[model samples]
Target: MDRVIYNFDSLSQRQSAATVPLRRSIYRARRVPEPRIGIIYNPRSHRNKGQDLACAGADNAMVAQPRTRDEIAHALAGFAREGIDFLIINGGDGTVRDVLTMGQAVFADRWPAIAVLPKGKTNALNVDLGAPADWSLEAALKAYASGRRILRRPLAVSRVDEDDPAMLGFIFGAGAFTLGIEAGQEAHSLGFFNSLAVGATGAWGVLQALFGTNGNKWRRGTQMDLRYLPGGAPLPRSKYGDPARRSVMLASTLERMPMGIQLFGAPRSGLKVAVLDRPRRRLLAALPAIFMGWRPRWLAEAGFHQLDADAVAIDVAEPVILDGEAFPAGRYRIEQGPELTFISV
Candidate 1:
């Protein structure tokens, strides 16, 4: 078996002599004609089970199925050190989250061009990136070679008070939204996936929020304080006169969402947020407009609010979910990270 080699001449020269080790790389003298490619495949992904990926297994292709977060970080570090040009994340949203969070420090601000294959239980990131469900590694590479690509910025989430490094991903949600994701995971275990799982989850969420009483976990919502960026102004109570409790809230830089549901209207660039205050009068009346991407003036007055923001600082009273993973209650800031190029083909 051929072993991968890394070149660290640039950084080793800057570090003290005692700390650096002797490293040899073919790249030291000659550059490869093709853009070096690295793939991080997750064998446990729902779609990858029992499948043979010969392209990924090729000797020239650098593929690593890291079993742990530390292994993932190590794999990304090696890819960066080897100067790979294209990174193909062949798994679900969780894999993408791990890459962005773990690879943030490895790549610094700049990231190599990336492509994703929607092979997970939930692939909202792939949909947002405009990659079709059938997109394959071969097609993505061909597209990159032909200059078919687009730019997107991952949401950088960081603890405001603690010194923990920021985590990068798309789709940050809280309150009932977090509970909905938990339901989605349940749907996954029932053999539902893709659009079916999303629809099933949505239907279940609606039932919980509708017939259930205020004491219901889904309807009671979570108490959270929000401070919009720049001026750090606090978000006011909903026009329905509801308190600081929010039924659901979602934030993202992605322009598209699963099932064509647009939480943040029109979906232009920058950070957009949609918050549904405690279900009030006309809550059912606003459902169509809310999911259809309509930004009617009456929507805000009815307790459904959408706003544009440069960044948002949130003090979450309960756990928050980003992509598909949950985090503890804390003061966190979620804003746009560096814009990255991605293969559209």
Candidate 2:
């Protein structure tokens, strides 16, 4: 039996049509074949508790709920071998990160279009992709079958050493950003999760960095050495303020961040970076304009540095936050990865 798959894009139009024959005529007029889909679901994700995975099963769709990283790798290998046209991830940020890292071997030089269901505590990537929290796997598969798509690139961070593995995700941060992650964890413990927790923790971090004295860890900042790649010139330390330390450092391939904040001055497509030196007198006032995407002429002179770079080397004194996971401190090379297609509408 050939199952009829409806195009999500035409759902509104089909529903408004007066008669069944008219809907049938529209369907026949615009019918397109469905693509083979593969779903990798993580049951342990925050919002995935007690969720139904059986609904994802279909004639052309394959759903695999993998419990371990090794299982995820194996599933991706099988999907690649089977030649799936689209891949849907049904979990949170950590699940997405793990899949991208483990599936790298199976998807070398070739990637199927991907879609994500926002099922996590903080779906930052999904928020940027404009996927709602209630987005379902069935709806996503339908979207893959016929709806519009948005292409995005992810940031790839790896240890400087060739032997070490690489991690793929949207956001990367250190210095005060690292401390903010710790505070965010505390906020989560107090029943403040999601976007509220993010904003609260961020506001607290900024306040601590402002009023706290020079010796405060969050204020004193971390020691890091940054060198631009392709040409190994050392990044200007004087531009930030203190040559030995920086208060905050962050990089992402995402244009819009959580809480609808525009962290970068301009909407850059690739890897974008923002760095701040130890607090200057005008640091408090400068933050508001920067958050609004304002490109004030004195931003750099006020010890705020933003740039778009092909690659950067970061040797840090502390652990950094990638997505929501904590990565060990080391010398890391950050670069942009290939463009990936994501479902929308």
Candidate 3:
């Protein structure tokens, strides 16, 4: 856990410290007035090369290398103190979540807009923002310098207890699917095909475990009470809730999944919340939908609702993974927060 923090007076000052070759391109753009920019990067992040390149491309970007989760929060607090106008996060989903969580506390006044550089195994949030999957620091800076506008949408935040603050952006889910993410991280560390490959393998492992002798271990499924607020209908409680019903594999953005597949519906479907469910069918049903776009319909038929609400709540007996971070094993509530605005290329 390393933390580096800097405050530059101008984009030209930032360009001077950039190490990427593409920084020159972004340096030529018009400079905005003292736009205090704060950047958080994970030193141990997998995509260091891309992050380095993106850092080199930005102007007047203050870089922080936070070693621990709390350190990252402190660095964000410093940025807020400096009155940062924009925050460019240069890591994967986990890093983004950490920064957003810190931002809510340090920059609660709706200042410091966020821009993302997807440099992680599963960049679901980056993909949603339409940022380049292969984003280098230089490319990211270029996009910002080229006058690209940032889009703000609501974010889903959640927490398990009063002592813990809510997580920023994304949903919570349990069952085999959530467990698969854990397995995928292990496979990824063991030299697998990165996050996407790890996810695929993890899903397979879940399937195998479900049918194996130990399958009965997790058979005592927990209960999930979902309530749609603002006058939406309440879902009827069912005894055997489909594992898929308890699970949600959704990307809040309009982009495709990392595997180049459209897990949600269409690009236009970006504005709406996409929910895929079917506990009874499990991955057996989701596999076909990934390749053929046919399974989501079945999931919808099984009472999986896809609402455009900015907020939602999930109360469960077991712990749920929001984005990629795991919370305590107990009931939790998730609701949509403010929308993160980004400048896309």
User: 2 or 3, which is superior by TM-score?
Assistant: 2
Tens digit of per-residue lDDT, candidate 2, span 19-102: 112111211112137666788989988788887775644666778999866678778877877877788898888789877866
In order, the Cα lDDT scores of the candidates are: 0.75, 0.75, 0.54
Better of 1 and 2 by TM-score: 1
Q: Pick the candidate with the highest lDDT.
A: 1
| Positional deviation of residue 303's Cα in model 3 after best superposition, in angstroms | 5.8
Candidate 3 lowest-lDDT run of ten: 1-10
**Considering TM-score, which of the candidate structures 1 and 3 is the better prediction for this target?**
1
Candidate 1 lDDT, tens digit per residue, 1-345? Answer: 001221122322222211223233321112235878889988877799899764832356688998766677778888878888888898888788777767766665546778888998879887877788988888777766664567778898888866566777898888988888888878888998987888898888888777888788988879888889858997655655347678888899888888888777876888888888876636755676678866677777778877888899998798888877777777889899876777775
Scored by lDDT, model 1 comes in at 0.75
TM-score of each: 0.87, 0.86, 0.72
Better of 1 and 2 by lDDT: 1
**Tens digits of lDDT, candidate 3, 149-262:** 655443554444444555665434465545566666676667664436645764665465456552343333445555555454554332344542444433354345555454
Q: How much is 91 displaced in model 3, in angstroms? A: 1.5
Query: Which sections of candidate 3 miss by over 4 Å?
Result: 1-34, 49-60, 152-154, 160-164, 193-195, 202-206, 209-220, 230-233, 236-256, 260-264, 267-278, 281-287, 290-292, 295-299, 303-307
